[model samples]
Target: MADRNTPNRPRQRIIERGIELLLALCGSISLLTTLGILGVLVWDSVAFFQDVSILDFLTDTQWTPLFADKHFGILPLLSGTFLTTLIALLVALPLGLLIACYLSEYVRPAVRNVLKPLLELLAAIPTIVYGYFALTFVTPLLQHLIPGLAGFNALSPGLVMGFMLLPLVSSLSEDAMQAVPSGLREGAAALGATRMQTAWRVIIPAAFSGVMVSVILAISRAIGETMIVAVAAGQQPRLTLNPLVPVETITTYIVQVSQGDVAQGSLEYNTIFAVGLSLFLLAFGLNTVGYFLNRRYREHYD
Candidate 1:
């Protein structure tokens, strides 16, 4: 037994060291991949800025890069993206929280088992499918309510995008609420607070970080969403604040240009990187703001 154990010990040590090395290698690969993407975007964006002045790119009112004479304004795309994202958040935020509150405070565990999966199934649906559904079903439904609604407008896509994000917000918010110490809920109840009052005052405040995380993630997802907005919101990048207008988002423009419509190595092609970098910055800024806001209201519920 001693002889066998001695041989096995050295072999096991070698295996353990090999596994550690493999994991380190895997982590390095992931970091390298991220750096590679950043490098490409920065390199191309620098080259693009050389041709299109940063001022023109930032302040240009028109974005007709594919035309004979180009206008490289980013306002149109940014506005569209913001419009759709804000609209989606307006729709999703309240509904998702209410759903989370109900699921956390009201529903039985058995019912949650049945309903949560069903809700999550929405997240599994392909974006293209949601886009088609928005185009065909949601748009028609909205036209009946709003006069002069465009055939392809921001509203339909925004509404569908909200629905697509609902599950994410609900799941995250519920998990956060669940993580709140049971003692807090019990203390509120012991003080004669009703179930609703306990969930509202006790659990929600304690789970503020989680709810904010869900909102930030939902906003990020909404901002990055492509096919649904592309299909439901028309491919025209108009600088209008109106949600009823047909506008093109940053992601839609990227997709449109990537379809071999623009020449390679041209200023237009370079704009894709610039636009993507801008988007990365936008999402980063949003997360940063949310972080500060969370910190402001965050409490130590103990």
Candidate 2:
């Protein structure tokens, strides 16, 4: 009996070791894939800069890669991207914060359970559908109301993008607000504070850092979004601040160039990488600021 048990124990140990090794290998492969993508992007962007001077790429405002006067000023694209993102944030931030506040403090539990999932469903909807809606429904509505709006202006697309980002901001901000200790609310109430007063003065201030992180995350998502902008926003890359006119964004440019007959190894191909690098840097910087804000400003009530 002892001999049989000893052999079985050894086999069991071997099986456990094999499972552990498999999981470790899988994790390593995932890490390698992420690192590989980053490596390729960096390498391609560096190669692009080698052919085109960094100064020209950064400072030139016109983005005519196919014409005889091929200039690659990335600023117009950057400005368009920023402008749209700013508009989206302006529309999303207040609505998202109010939703977060409602869910965290004001709503009944039954209502919250029903509504939260429905709101999150908005996030799960495919961006292509949003793009189509923007093109068909939103643009016409804007044109009817504003009279001077184009068939494809920045306002409709930006507003739709804001709607898309609202769930993310609200869900994250709600979680942060909910994480505030109940004792704080109780203390405020004990001190004769109303529910709204406690929420606005104590809860929101305590959760400000996390709320800011959510807002930044929404902005990042707005910046990286491609499909809605590609389908709804026009392909004209201008440096104007007029939101009513047609404008091209960085992501839209990438989609336009990738879909068209732009030859590989040409200046146009390199311009894609240059624009992509700028986007990557912008996202990286926003994420870095979010990290610092989370670290430095979060008020721990424990």
Candidate 3:
């Protein structure tokens, strides 16, 4: 019996080691792939900057990368990206927070179980489908409501992106609200505080950090989004703050350049990398802030 047990133990150890080795190999492969992409982006962007001055790339108001007389100022694209993302966040945050409050504090348990999954299903839809919906459905609706709105302006696309990001913000916020202790709500009720008052004044303040992180994450998604902006927003890069006009974004520009016939070694080809680097930096900054806020102010209900 002892000899049999010894043999089985070795076999089990071999299987466990095999699983560990496989997991490590897979992790290393994923990390290397990510690093390779970043390295390539940096390499191409460096080539672009070597040919063009950093000041011109950053401050120039025009983006005429495809023109015979090219000016590679990236500010317009950056501004457009920010404008749309800001609009998206403005629409998403309030609606999402309200939905979260309803889900966490007001809804019956049976209703919540069904509604939560349905709401989360929004996140599972393809972004390209959302893009098409923006172009066809949302743009026309805006044209009816807001006269003088262009066919491919920032408002429709931004609004659609807001809808797309709503589920993310709502679900995360709901989780945070639910994390608030039941005792607090009971104590507030005992003091004659209404449910609405407790939710708005007491619970929301406690969950503000988590909700802020969720909002930041939604902003990052809006910024990185490609298909909706590309399909709905026009490809004209301009320095304009008006949401009613057609504006190009960094993601849209990247898509445009990638689909063109530019040579791999030319400035136009390398410009894609430059824009991508800017986007990467923007996302990284937002994520860093979100991470620190979550760590510093996350509530411990227990």
Candidate 4:
């Protein structure tokens, strides 16, 4: 018995060590990948900044770096990105919250189990399909109602992107609401609060941090979205707030420059890296803010 147990212990220890090493490698892969991306962005962006001043890049309103007459102002792309993100959030937040409240507070477990998966299936649809759907279906339909809306405009794509992001917001929000203790609901009922009142006043507030984290994540997703904006929203980089007109986003510009026409190692080619770096910064900022907010407001239940 002693000989058998001693041999098994060494074999088990070897297997455990192998598993530990594999897990450590898996964890480091993501961090290493992130560092690699940051290094590339910084390296290329340095070359791009040599010819184009950072001041001009920030202050200039034009973005025609592809043309013979060059401009590198990022405001147009920034505006378009923010515009679409705002429109998407407007469409997603209210509807998502309503759906979440319904799922979390009103529905039975059986109904919620069935409905949540159906709702989340929307996220599985390819983004390219959504882009084409916006162009072929939603844009023409909107043109009939909105007299002057362009064929390739921000409104159509923004709306489609909003719907694309709906599942994310609703699913995360529902999870947050579900995390609230059942005792809270019972107490609210005891105090004569109706379902709507309890959800609006208690559950939502309790889950605010989680909901906000979901929203921030959705915003980052909206900003980083490429296909729908590229296919539906035209490539015209104009710094305007009107949703009826065509505009270009940072991701679209990266896609445009990456299409093989632009020479590698050239200023135009390097612009993508610079734009990508800016996008990285923006996303990082939002995620950092979300992290702090979550830490600040997160509730710990016994």
Return the TM-score for each candidate structure: 0.93, 0.91, 0.91, 0.96
Clashes of each: 0, 1, 0, 0
Q: lDDT per prediction? A: 0.92, 0.87, 0.91, 0.94
Which of 1 and 2 is ahead in TM-score?
Answer: 1
Name the regions of candidate 2 deviating beyond 4 angstroms. Answer: 1-30, 299-302
lDDT against true structure, model 1: 0.92
* Clashing residue pairs, backbone N/CA/C < 3 A, model 4: none
Off by over 4 Å in 4: 299-302
Which run of 10 residues does model 1 get worst, by summed lDDT? 293-302
The pairs that clash in candidate 1 are none
Candidate 2 lDDT over 82-172, as tens digits, reads 8788889998999999899999999998999999999999999999999899999999988989979988788889999999998999999
Give the winner by lDDT: 1 or 3.
1
Q: What's the distance in Å from true for residue 67, model 2?
A: 2.2
TM-score of 3: 0.91
Candidate with maximal TM-score:
4
Q: Rank the candidates by TM-score, best first.
A: 4, 1, 3, 2
lDDT of 4 by residue, 1-302 (tens): 89869879988999999999999999999999999999999999999999999999999999999999999999999999999888888898898899999999999999999999999999999999999999999999999999999999999999999999999999999999999999999999999999999999999999998899889999999999999999999999999999999999999999999999999999999999999999999999999999988887874422
